[model samples]
Target: MRIVRRVFVPTLVVVVAVIVGSGIAGGREAFGGAAVGGGLTLAFLGASPGLLDPVAKASPVASLPVALGFFTVKAVAAVAVLMLLLGDDGRGPQLSSRAVAAAMIITALTWVTLHFRALRRVRTPIYDLG
Candidate 1:
């Protein structure tokens, strides 16, 4: 139960936010397709061995740009999810306006919780000295 509350629920919230947001912002076709594609790409990249060998071999200076690029893509995906949720309702699920509004509100609250948790962690530092 504790794990469900602390981990599963939060994860679910983020996922719902991403999916609904993407669907709404990009319309059904573009946003949904992008979401699917992005998930597959991430999975493939993560599963593939030696995919990061070149980056690992690169100097820190050379790898910095790659790291930045990776983060940028993630940020873009996050924005895309939000934008998609708030954008036109293309040939996707015809959720009522009220439902969409509710979903937006829920997503916002979820994000707030996530941010709050991160802030709490930052503010209350814990040190582990082995």
Candidate 2:
């Protein structure tokens, strides 16, 4: 919920703005961005709970392997899902493959950044004075 409010929501705003701007500025490319953004959003949202679940229970060393593995799987799944939804290389009528790629990359990076931010918010003492 906090992640939704703090990260996903804000990222969505930016992605949507890109969609609108691209529509006006880039015309067809806007659809490409929308597809990428929307797909990425769904992919990450679905996977986030599972990823975060292990983070809470495992040591950081242990967590890294799980996180990396899941991240890779999620990324691959995102691409596969987009290919199915958007067609070959994210191209369809009036769609720009480049724009779709750009938006997907942006969405992925934004999600990672937000994940880190959420992790930081977890209350853990580095050095217990007591």
Candidate 3:
């Protein structure tokens, strides 16, 4: 929870950049990107720092499997939730299929970029042979 604010400060820049870009290209897409990207990425960021907290005990190589399994499950569940919520014509987004697609792309990019940066910066012992 303490890290959420710090982590998100950087992402706010991305949200604004995407919003401005998407707004010029498409208003609804901008809105959808902000809503979904902002919401989901923040949620992901909030959970992720802690999800990999245990990985601090492991080497980067050892952390891969844990990280992979963690994200695969999260991705599958996210898809399932979206499937139930969004209709064929993207009824839930209040915009269009295009906007929903924008949102998904925005969320994914934001998550991946930030998470990779976090992983790089995560603290680990200098010499943990395991």
> Top lDDT: which candidate number?
2
lDDT of 1 by residue, 20-125 (tens): 6667775655445445434433332332223234675766566667766765775676456545653465323433334334444444455456545755655444
Residue 95 in model 2: lDDT? 69
Best by TM-score: 2
Task: Please give the lDDT score at residue 48 for candidate 3.
Answer: 62
Residue-level lDDT for 5 in candidate 2: 59
Runs off by more than 4 Å, candidate 3: 1-7, 16-33, 58-66, 91-93, 110-130
Model 1, total clashes: 6
Lowest-lDDT window of 10 residues in candidate 3? 91-100
Tens digit per residue, CA lDDT, model 3, 16-125 = 67656666777764566446645555565556657776684666666778888888877786666556656554566554445546655765676677756775777758
**Between candidates 2 and 3, which one is better according to lDDT?**
2
- Evaluate model 3: give its lDDT: 0.62
Residue range 57-118, candidate 2, lDDT tens digits: 76666777777778788778877876775687456566676667667677767777876888
Off by over 4 Å in 1: 1-93, 118-130
